[model samples]
Target: MERVRITDDGFTTLFSTEFNQYYHSVRGALDETQRVYIELGLLAKMQETNEINILEIGFGTGLNALVTALEAQKNNLTVQYTTLEPFPISEEDVSSLNYQTGAETDLLQKLHHVKWHENIEISPNFSLQKVNCTLQEFKTSQLFDVVYYDAFAPSSQPELWTVETFTHVASFLKKGGFLTTYCSKTVVRRAMEQAGFKVEKHIGIWGKREVVRAIKL
Candidate 1:
């Protein structure tokens, strides 16, 4: 099994024989998760729905999950989250994540060490379950309101970002559900479009000029 090492920007970096490019970079990691997944995608969906169910791909270091949970509490929204990670970091590796200090400290700790593979209730408004399995094999009976497609870049993990995988995810979304990703590749955009999604380009953070977001109709 490969190990996840911490990056200077306080994020985890995993090297998979599968995807190659350091998995994640801390400097841009939180920005991407918070901006694209939590703020823009998940929180936006909560405005109209009382209960929001979110599915996140590549649950690296639990950053996205943690952000979503905290956002739910702060915004007075109820969220049930499920994440799929094929190669999860060990608990000790998670503890090593250098999360930001001050107001983010307590939640950072909880997010770092929350038990894996079980539906753990982190707060009144938030609960999460993680599956340490490949995305290809993970299945759920329930449809979701939001999907955070936080996989590696298409240049790294082509299969995860491919049309086949997204098509599978598309089937799991309820009408009008949205999937947000940091990829802006034309091939990926085309893939999302072919998967029965209405694709749109959105401005991205962290020097990322553009990102692709898809809605299932």
Candidate 2:
């Protein structure tokens, strides 16, 4: 069973007793999502086009997907999001989250309740396909405009941050597509470069110094 805890900021995060890790920083879950993935990854791409396709590596808590959906709705942009997660949280645990408090809460619930492996339209402009698989097992020929590489740190799950792993994911991105993550480790950045990404560093969210944004060129 997965153990979870609510942060001081009132957002829920998964605690991996096995890994001795938390799915997100205790500083603020929503803040980190907005800063790293939504603002840097999605919004940056949104500036280039009105429509976007996004691939997410770790779909823990479905927070990134929900925030992306809300941002797309706000900007009136079309989004096609595909996410991979080998272990999904239970519906009961999802229901207990206090992430969203208003009309957005319904949208968040819809995101969790929707069927996996099928592209389901969550709203007029946001469509999602949740794949229940690991990154190595995920296979698709479709290309994406953005990727949210929110995997666990290399210290805990080093294999996921390797050149081989990034090469696999980069194969699915269109030229100029961007992959953003909260991880800014030099080895990870080098791995992304080895995978053919033109990598750049950006200011990270609170408590973290830097993050990475890599471009498929």
Query: Which candidate has the highest lDDT of all?
Result: 2
- Give me the candidate number with maximum TM-score: 2
**In lDDT terms, how accurate is model 2?**
0.88
Error of 1 at 194 (Å): 0.8
- Candidate-wise lDDT, in order: 0.78, 0.88
Expressed as tens digits, the lDDT of each residue in 11-118 for candidate 1 is 665555656655555456667677788766887787788699999888876778777777787788899888888877666766666654465677756755666778
Off by over 4 Å in 2: none
lDDT of 1 at 205: 74
Task: Give each model a TM-score.
Answer: 0.86, 0.94
Model 1 TM-score, all chains together:
0.86
